[model samples]
Target: MSANPSPGSPRVALVTGTSSGIGAAVVKTLCDLGHQVLAVDFNPAGETVAEASGAAFFQADLTDAEACRAAVGDAVKRFGHVDILVNNAGIQHVESIESFPEAKWRQIIDLMLTAPFLLTQAAWPYMREGQWGRIINIASVHAQVASPGKAAYISAKHGLIGLTKTAALEGGEHGITANALCPAYVRTPLVDNQIADQARMHGMGEQEVIEKVMLKNAAVKRLIDPSEVASLVAYLASDQAGAVTGSSWNIDLGWTAQ
Candidate 1:
């Protein structure tokens, strides 16, 4: 072990959406790597996942601006300083732009786009002090390509990419690198619900929706695994990835290769 802490050393990581799916996998992966992880999610059920993964849980509605800052503060209090941040909490609503509810659109933007910005701003000072940090925003393939429905999710993710680039530029001198991960449909509760919603909206079976609608543009014929995405997150959070920032790394299984 080294006397001084560095990016390669275990660091404090604050991850959002720790209840299930990609967020849960990220918490587990980071904790297994010996990082002190503070798992934040709106669901109280996440406490169990955190305990099982050897992470501390912070329950908060990140759509609330104050809650975003509080999550960073909680991480600092628990682990002394935050060295990594994973903004992965989100939900999807499948509806045409004209038919989508106004309130729901605002809610999605608040949670997906605004919360990440607030959390990043809150964590900036600590990382600047340490001269090292990683901010990974869990964007989707929709960040690059759009679909018929899912106007709100697509919009938020697109905006998140812009945020990631701007943060990366601003944090360059301070050694705080920011990047976005764009993955295709991962096998998550959120994507499962999205499949169901898409089927209902398109008047098709769920399997048909998955095959024809979801994988229509892809060369690969399967949904991505949460662990696969988590593996990438591990690399981005490592000292080796210090030079990789301000870019959206795609994990889509040949979805956009065409």
Candidate 2:
């Protein structure tokens, strides 16, 4: 027997940032595995992707607290209950601290850090009422370490881990597990957008940036596929992983191994 809800009782999964990249892969993976996923993203394209994946779509600007709450409310309204909450929605703004915009800093923190906290707060009742839950934050390896020119992104990611720990501590006796996945340089649009910035900063070709800058510390020396991260999300969201909480699971090709 599977160590999860029975085949007929699929978990109602709510995934943010499902328009593309790891979030999209996660939505597709959960749906393909027979879970009912509610895909949430501000992007209209997310609705199309969610529809194509046979998951319900809820469009919302996650930076807004009302929108965050609505995302959870809509999931509960549609699926009757939310069993898995995946905080994968995020944006990247790369610039030196001296040049970073205040608005951008607040924007990234609101979306990446504050939004997850809000969503978790909104979904707490459902998870608590049912006495079963899984909360997965799609944090980056930046959560553990730092690099230059990403002040807001790095700070928010680091804050997210702390939020994850607190959520885990509170939910431990309530049958809820909260954990974060820290992945490095996945082949996503987010990373694709940063290549040029990294290249200019390092005075190298884009390919050189990837080879020397991005993959330099990683033992595997290759970008991770979104599906690889999705697989870990699947494991973390499973009943078998009941004991895995308040942990930062890294899929960074051994970047942090050193």
Candidate 3:
């Protein structure tokens, strides 16, 4: 065990989007390291995943600010303090700028970008109180690079990296660290849910979307596993990474190397 686990004890991690995929993997990763996790997601299925991971689950629609606040409150109530926050809640909408639905764009912005802000705003006090905190945002390669027909997604992800940098600056003096994980196409339900949509938009088969559309830019052509990302999260949330903050760590198969 490290010299100090979290805030004051075994770390308590609050991970959103825990219903499946990377979120579930993160919950397991943190738990295996002896941290208590509060898993939050609007999906009812999240409760099952939470149970399996031995985590406390909060079913919440994070698009609502109050719901964002309440989820953090529930985490504190369950574990007494929040030591780490993994802002992993998000949804994907694929469409060109000219035809994308306004409501869908707003929802994606609210859920993906706005929710992290509110959750961090709410969790900051607990972290500051303990003089220790970790904020990990699950951004995408879209945060730095872009593709056609994904105006909202690319925009939101780009903005998330900006937020990550700003938060890192503000949290530095308080023993709080904020960082973003920018991964290429990871084999998560989030990516699976988009295959049919990408196929329709690109006029290609689902497999083609995975190969050409998804992996085309990467030097290493493979879908990143959720466990691979989880391992990084575990390290960032650990005491050894205390000096690392305000950075966007890319696990993108050398996609951005060019």
Best by lDDT: 1
Candidate 2 Cα errors over 4 Å, as ranges: 1-8
lDDT of 3 by residue, 1-258 (tens): 122243434698999999888999999999888899999999998899998988989999999999999999998887787889999988898888999999999999999999999999999888888788899999999999989888888888899998889989999988899999999989988899899999999899999998888988899989999999999999999888999999899999999999
- Lowest lDDT sum, 10 consecutive residues, model 2, at 1-10
Q: List the residue pairs that clash in candidate 1.
A: none
lDDT of each: 0.93, 0.92, 0.91
Residue 40 alpha-carbon offset, candidate 2, angstroms: 0.7
TM-score of model 1 relative to the true fold?
A: 0.97
lDDT of 2 by residue, 164-247 (tens): 999999998889999999999999988998999898877899999999989989999799999999999999988889999999
The CA-based lDDT of model 3 is what? 0.91
Which candidate, 1 or 2, has the higher TM-score?
A: 1
TM-score per prediction, in order, is 0.97, 0.96, 0.96
Candidate 1 lDDT over 38-82, as tens digits, reads 999999999999999999999999989999999999988777888
Specify the poorest-scoring 10-residue window by lDDT in model 3.
1-10
Residue 91 in model 3: shift from native, Å?
Answer: 0.7
Candidate with best TM-score: 1
